[model samples]
Target: MTSTLDDALKRLEMAVGLLEASVSRRLEAENRRGDLETELQLMQDDRARLAVELDSALTRLHRFEAATDDVSRRVRQAIGAVQSVLVQAGQLEPEEG
Candidate 1:
């Protein structure tokens, strides 16, 4: 009878130990899940901010392109005028093409 009781006690202790270990693992998993959720939120916020920045940069790029086109047109006109003046003064020949 004593041997049976000892065996039962040992089994009970082992079961309790296993239960504790399982609980610990579950808690750890929950903590990790919380951390992951926080990280995901941060990533989402960063993505939103980056998207806004990208849009602003694109808008600035378009504006710069328009300004560049305007400057290019003005430069071409000035070059043509200079060429005409040179041709009329007989300092340069008119282009054939």
Candidate 2:
């Protein structure tokens, strides 16, 4: 939907084309005709899979960081509250003569 996506698609297409050409040229040396279409399809599938995995990983990382920050904040607040209570209770306790 965005220009960035369009750019990425273009780059991927170019890379696929380059890969197909390279494989074909290399196979020609061995008297073999490689299936460029199949290779391209495989590459595309791999790219898609990696993209999905990356997105999932990034989402999880963000959630983990947010949860960590939330817990840290709560812990700091709890510690301060406990410290205050301890100080008050210490003052209230009668001292030995």
Candidate 3:
């Protein structure tokens, strides 16, 4: 009877130890999950910010390209006017394609 009681107590202790180890593992997993979630949120926020910055850069680039095109057109028109005046003054011969 005494041996049976000791065996039962030992089994109970082993069971408690196993339970504690399982709970510890679960708590550690939960903590790691929380950390990963926070990091993922930060990454998502950074991605959004980068997307906005990229869009702004593209918009500015488009405006600059449009301005460059306008300048080029105006320069071409001025050159054509100068060529016409020179031709009328007999200072330059007419160009042939």
C-alpha lDDT values of all predictions: 1.00, 0.87, 0.99
Candidate 2, residues 1-97: lDDT per residue as tens digits?
6899999999999999999999998878655334666688899999999999999999999999999999999999997778778768884443355
Best by TM-score: 3
lDDT digits (tens) for residues 1-97 of candidate 1: 9999999999999999999999999999999999999999999999999999999999999999999999999999999999999999999999999
TM-score of 1: 0.86
Poorest stretch of ten by lDDT in candidate 2: 29-38
Per-residue lDDT tens digits for candidate 3, residues 1-97, read: 9999999999999999999999999999999999999999999999999999999999999999999999999999999999999999999999996
Question: What's the lDDT of the predicted structure labeled candidate 2?
Answer: 0.87
lDDT of 1 at 56: 100
What stretches of model 1 exceed 4 Å from their correct place? none
Q: Over 4 Å off in model 2, which ranges? A: 1-34, 91-97
TM-score of each: 0.86, 0.57, 0.87
lDDT of 1: 1.00
